[model samples]
Target: MSDDLIPGDESSAADAADAVYRELLERLGEAQPQPRLGATKRALELLGNPESSFAIIQIAGTNGKTSTARMIESILRAHGLRTGLFTSPHLVRFTERIGIDGERISDEAVARNWDDIKPYLAMVDAELTAAGEPALTFFEALTVLGFACFGDAPVDVAVVEVGMGGAWDSTNAADAEVAVFTPIDLDHVQRLGKTIAEIARTKAGIIKPGAQVVSAAQHPDARQAIVDAAAAVDDPAVFEGEEFALVQDAVAVGGQLITVRGRAGTYPELYLPLYGDHQGRNATLAIAAVEAFLGGATQPIAEDVLAEGLTEVASPGRLQLIGTEPTVLVDAAHNPHGAASLVAALGSYFDVDEIAFVVGILQDKDAAGILTTLAPAASGFFFTQSESERAIPAEELSRLAASLDLPASTFADTLDEAAEDARRWAEEAPRRLVVITGSITLVGEAIEVADDREWKATA
Candidate 1:
């Protein structure tokens, strides 16, 4: 517990570090939930305001946030700018949370930086105790560490993914030159408000005073909330499909090809290698954000650089195909809105009679809603729990899927076994698709198993 002690100084150092990080995360879950706009500022104030050391592109929404953040970072990097990207809920290693110069920060870097920041963390804890306040949660500490990493590396810009709702989320502490909103929907009713209006209001909190706001096309109510929130901050709002638009979208050779028209300019034949109609919208937001970041200081963006940038960007787990021949696609569609998008994209890309599905979900998610959207397109369900302690139990999830009168079965705790079962069942023909979805954790596990099995190679 002492700051001077290094968790991994000995043979058990790795385990000790894991234990420390786990404890931090638990404390973060237990800490007072700020769910408002200024908690980040308080945390940053305690940390010497490292968040202001660099410019930022702030992204918040119910979905596509990670993709949008990656797209913006890629575009910025292609323009010869050194960029730092911070995202969350890693698919594999925890180090995926921070990317510098388009690569995951090295494990050595994570450990060394964590060790260096432990003293600051201890100080923060002591101050909280003295003030009769809860200690910094794992997320708060990690947010501080990101600022430290970015400041230390001294990247020109940082693309920050909001941990949860925008306003009170810890990442909001950073000053953003451009605030981007991906679509908003009902999720995280506990921390964020339940209604669309409430969720929209909470997300709109990221729009800073004088920042340029670029948003994915939103529902009318959500759009209004953003408008009102921007007015309060006196920020200029660029509404997708209104202030800017993607005039054309189609499947290109490398990925999706689209054209965007901003308020003041137009970009043609932009190639983004990600799939899905939603990505087209996400790409437009990214383009608008890049334009906004440039501050009209440059003429229209260089098309050659933009094309290369978009083609090189990769967002794993969003309609990602992990195997072929009874193709296995892994999508992190944990909610109804995302599930709907996944279904639409599948419809666009593949034609199959029966879609076999492996699904595991968290308890906080709308299980019934997600199932409803996916069940119609599914032939059967292989139910299991993903990585969250909050995940719905396998049997219970099966029952929920069965209540919809869809053929469903529960699996043992191991994702590897569950995925094996799903693949075997779908192997009557190689083209019969197997889909593992619901939570990113489950998809990650499935991907790991599929990799070990060489499922794609054999398929």
Candidate 2:
């Protein structure tokens, strides 16, 4: 291998970080989050409760949680706060899940922190075993490690995205000062609950006794659940379409222009370089979240700070263009709601008619709902799978697609090959594009493939 691919010392650090991730995988995966935080809290307590060392803003929802968390982190950083951001299901490296000041936490940092926390975690594991309970799952351990990393960095604030439904997700142990909810819908039905109300109620558990609550527009059932949760704590949750809203948004070059009516003030004429009208709502929710965090939504953020934050905001793997001359876009739109937003963004942001989607869905996801949502705008489907063991097989996906009367393409040994074939088909016609979607795991693998192949975007 060339030194360009793996330089001596730097490559060693990355390999070490990868080793840390592998050790985490040896535990139970995040597919089934444990319904209790006692294990996580016990581990943290042994480490002096590092999560309590910094102020936290925790986000929970079925969709847009990671994007909204990034926005809040960026704005807080723009305001001169040393910020720590933790999002889920990294699109490239495990380090991407934890960030210090908008940059991925370094490989060396991840390795060092994991080493420091291993002993404390082992103690917690023994305690759980003795009590006849399961040890901490992958996400639970990772949350502890992430918070320890942030506390050691001594950040001014930390923005965290829940790994799953909020109530018992390990990050909930942090007791975030601001509880932010993105749109809640049917997701993780097996683990969370069967209906939207059940899921939303599970999510609202992040709202503690005195935490400020900020929410995006939600289904009536979802909204009521959050309202009830907040009232129980004597906290009035500020919501979009009510106290705050995405007042205006128009398609702009490379992104969109937006105006938001926040609880404390009105932010007009903002340039947010993220696709979808959904992103505009995510931005408004983020603004309100920061408002509540800094000054209880009673003082407006300075216009320049807000402008800088929005201008620099980025939501990768969400309508992100990875190539040109054929036009390949990757979006982590695994569920029906996110799929609907992707279709809308394509209609509004780009001049594409037919899309050949290189798709892969997880084992337990709502494949029918997601594919059905995309079927109306799709020309063909290139069924594929990621390295994730949870990914549904390409042949199985092909069978599902055929049953839906959607055209299916041949499978490939790898996602990169599938994307290449889809892009080739797209390049043969005018105003056609290739989209890679359905799972974050697939998008993450596609990103690595894109980087390796140097798929530069001319547009």
Best TM-score among the predictions, by candidate number: 2
For residue 314, give model 2's deviation from the true position in Å.
1.3
Each candidate's TM vs. the true structure?
A: 0.92, 0.96
Mind giving the per-residue lDDT tens digits that candidate 1 earns over 360-436? 99888899999889977887888888767778888888777777776666565767777778888888865578889
Best lDDT among the predictions, by candidate number: 2
Report the lDDT tens digits of candidate 2 across residue range 1-459: 222224347877788888899999999888867899889999999999998889999999999999999899989999999999999988887888999998989887788889899999999999999999888889999999999999999898999999999898999998989999999999999999999999999999999998989999899999999999999999869898988999899999989999999888998999999999999989999999999999966899889999899888888899998887788899999999999999998888988778889999998899989999998888888989999988898888888888888765667757977888897898788989999999999998998898888887544
For candidate 1, report its TM-score: 0.92
Considering only N, C-alpha and C atoms within 3 Å, which residue pairs clash in candidate 1?
A: 8-13, 28-137, 36-168, 325-430, 326-430
What are the RMSDs of all candidates, in order? 3.1, 3.0
